[model samples]
Structures are given as structure tokens and as C-alpha cells.
Target: MSKFTLRFNTIAAALALSGLFATNLAVAEDIRVISSGGFAQAYKNLASAYEKSSSDKLISGWGPSMGTTTNAIPVRMARGENIDVVIMVGDSLDTLMKEGKLVAGSKVVLANSLIACAVKTGNAKPDISTVEGLKQAFLQARTVAYSDSASGEYIKHQLMKKLGIAEQMQGKAAQIPATPVGEIIAHGEADFGCQQRSELLPVAGIDIVGLLPQEVQLSTPFSAAIVSGSKVQKNAQALLDFLSSEKNAGVIAETGLEPVAAKK
Candidate 1:
């Protein structure tokens, strides 16, 4: 071929390649995910990065993994809502697996979520370092709020019992559903609040006092699973991969989530 002809052919190939790249960028898939507040921030971190890398859009919803309330993920699944993936407290995800709402062999631990205590940004940070301190904070606060999740359930049932202030907390504590406890405190609706640390870290206008004392602490592992019959199974798995990557460890930690140890 002549030099001019060769140059023209190369230019044509370059244009074709550019067109393919543009098409890939424009062709996007929507991956719908439902997870509890505990894992929402970490999931958001993964979703925002995944969208850029995969050219897929993420549609995420927040709620408890299981509950009698309409906002629960289990309730949404029962209503036949389409979901590509679920990130929630582990035992609840196990219930989905048992009920066949999620595919078998798709469950993976993402992180261990621990509970946190918070007060409004301008308020004095209360010490919850001891069991007595935790009890004092609740007894002294005018209003206390907690997520109506497993962590919250523990606070309502076990923690209150341990503190021996179960009766005192009655009517004084509020259970915030489908929302973070830190947010309620931030809004000044509640003078004291506790929720999953990951959920609290992302909310503005709140100061995280600290993790609950070991004597009254409750931690649950947050996990991800592909929803059964999802059309975007492959894409959902891609999101899980991004969340589980070693590079995301720092991001996860910053949100008060303990990265899951790699399985042997």
C-alpha cells in the first residue's frame, strides 16, 4: 500500500476505537441494591467508584434487613421488588438465603459493624467507656434514639437489661427506622443516640462519642449477597468485588467498619 493509504487506514482504525469507547461509556446498566444503614456508607463508597469503572448506575435503598415494618428489605422482597444485590446484617441475609430470596453461594462477608454513640455536634461528648458511664448517659439524657435494627434491638433488650435501667429507658428512648440514630441526634430530635458506627460516621452535625463499652457492646457482621433471579448478577458481583478489595480497607475503617478478614 502507498504511505498515504496506510495513514488513512490508521486514522480509520483510531476513529473506530474511539467510537467503541464512547459506546461503552454510554451503555449503562442499573444495578439496584438494598442495604441497611449500617452498611450504607461503605456501599456508597463502593458504588460511586464502581459506577465510574464499569459504566453502570447504582440505585440504592436503605432499611433494616428484617423487620415487621414495610421498609424492611424482607418486606420489599416479599412484595417482589427487583433488587440486584443486598448488603445487610449477616443473620438477616442468611434468612433471605433460607427463604430463597437470595441465591445460594452468593453470600460474602463485607465487614463487621459495631455500634456507636453520638450527640449533637455542639453538645458535650459523653463518656461511654464504662458500663456505668453508658447507663448514666441514658439515664441523664432527655431523649435517646437508636436504629431499630439488630444493634438497636440489643440496646432495647440486652443492653438495657445489663445496665439495670430497662424501666427508666422506657418511653424515653425512640426507635428510628430506615434512618441513622446519629442523624436524629444531629437534628436535635434526640439528645443522645446510638447506631452502627458506619451509619453514624457519614452523617453531618453529630459527634461520635465512641464505640459502646465491651460490657454492653453488640457487633454484627455486615454482608453482601446477590438477589435471586437478578438480571444483573454479573454486575452485582462486580460491585461486591469492589467492596471486598484490599484497597478499600482504609475507607471501610474510616467509617468504623472492620474489614472482613480474607478467607483461607
Candidate 2:
């Protein structure tokens, strides 16, 4: 072969290999996040944007009681699962901080949630305009539902007792196990169910009633933190920052969660 031809072929091979390397680099790094039902939808939405802007894949592991209000970080830590980031209740994060599971400086409240009620799609939307109306609706519900998670526990301990229906709701009210609380209503197995606003929005076949009245509402702040000794510390922090940004607030609101306002 001619020397000129040999040089051209060698240059072509070098360019092709370099192009392959560049393509691989353009793909994002996959980072695993452990989150509970409350912030799952919001975080998933933020993950899409983060992946596009930063070359890293956001992998989320969702648990019903795993990171939910009642169980929080302790369950995951006990289970010994590999988690890069945790998104759960603020109180739960504080517990982890006490245990040194979450890095101290990395914790941030991403969103706050209010409990809301849901019914099967196409069902008559119950009147929850007033506390009295909500009380009536709860009493009238043939089979009410609530979670065994944080919000559920609150409903049982505080709300029901306050409403004077803890005994009335005893046998008729269904306590959902590990499944999504909204699922029970969506499947027509329960007349009504309550869960975090963010959790109910993503679920299909369920229509959300507005949040509980302010007087009776339960607001649970959802926070995120990088787990201590996480391998992908930078990537996990990026995901948390992205979720906490103003740009992501729209999605957060759409999912039935309110973004934590920036402190002055």
C-alpha cells in the first residue's frame, strides 16, 4: 500500500475510536437513591432533568414503609441496603443524623406534604370544604382506608381521636399493609383513603379530594440527605440540589407537594 493511503487509514481508525469514547462519556453516571412514597414522584421527575443536564442516571428505590414517615431511615439502615441518597421525613433524617447514617452538612428539607383523601375515579367527589364536611365524609364512608405509615399513624392516633371516631372507624376502616394507600381506593376496594398529596397524584384511577382543613391537616416535611460513606457522593448531592431548586418546584407542586421555601 502507498504510504499516503496507510496514513489516511490509521487516522480514520483513531477518529472512530475517539468518537466511541466521547459517546460513552456523554452518557450520565447512574446513581442509586432510596426514597419513600411521599417524595418518590417529585424526585423521579427531577431525576429526568438532572440526567439530561448532568451525565448521570438517577436510580430511585422506593419503599412503602422503608422511607415513609413512620419507618424512615432506620429501616433501610437495619436492612443494610446499598443507598446513595435518602429522601424521607425531617424527623426521620434527624434520627439518622443522631446515628451518623446521614452526613451532617448535607441534609436539606426538599418538600413538605399535607395529607389528602382520594376516591375511585368517576366516584362522586366528597365535600371536604369544611372540617364538618370532612367529618361527615369520614363517617359516611363504608370502608375508609389509611396507611400504616407515618401519616396513617397520625390519622389514627390524632385525627380520629380528635374527631371522636376512633371507635366508630375501628372495624370498618381498612388499614392498608405495605401497598400504596391510594391503591386501595383506586382499585375500588375502599370507599376513601388518605395519604400524602404527592403520593396520591401519580396513582391512576384515583381522584384526590383537597387537603384536609388547616385545623386538622398534618404537614410532614420531607427531607433529603446523602448517606454517610456513599460511594457516589457528588452525584447524590446533585440530585438533592436539583430537587430543592425552584425549577423543580412546579413538578413538586403538581405532584401534590409544596416545595420548602428558601430561608431569608
Number of the top lDDT candidate: 1
**Tens-place lDDT digits, model 2, residues 102-159:** 8889998888889999899998888887888888889999999888667887888899
Q: Itemize residue pairs with steric clashes in candidate 2.
A: 28-55, 28-56, 29-55, 29-56, 29-57
Query: Which residue ranges in model 2 land beyond 4 Å of their true spot?
Result: 1-28, 65-73, 261-264
On TM-score, the candidate that comes out on top is 1
- TM-score for candidate 1, please give it: 0.85
Q: What TM-score, computed on C-alpha atoms, does each candidate reach?
A: 0.85, 0.83
Compared with the true structure, what per-residue lDDT tens digits does model 1 show for residues 63-149? 787677787988899999988999888998998899898989999898898888999998998899988898899999999998788
For candidate 1, which ten residues in a row score worst on lDDT?
255-264
Candidate 1 segments exceeding 4 Å error: 1-28, 261-264
Which ten-residue region of model 2 has the weakest summed lDDT? 64-73
User: What C-alpha lDDT do the candidate models reach, one value each?
Assistant: 0.86, 0.81
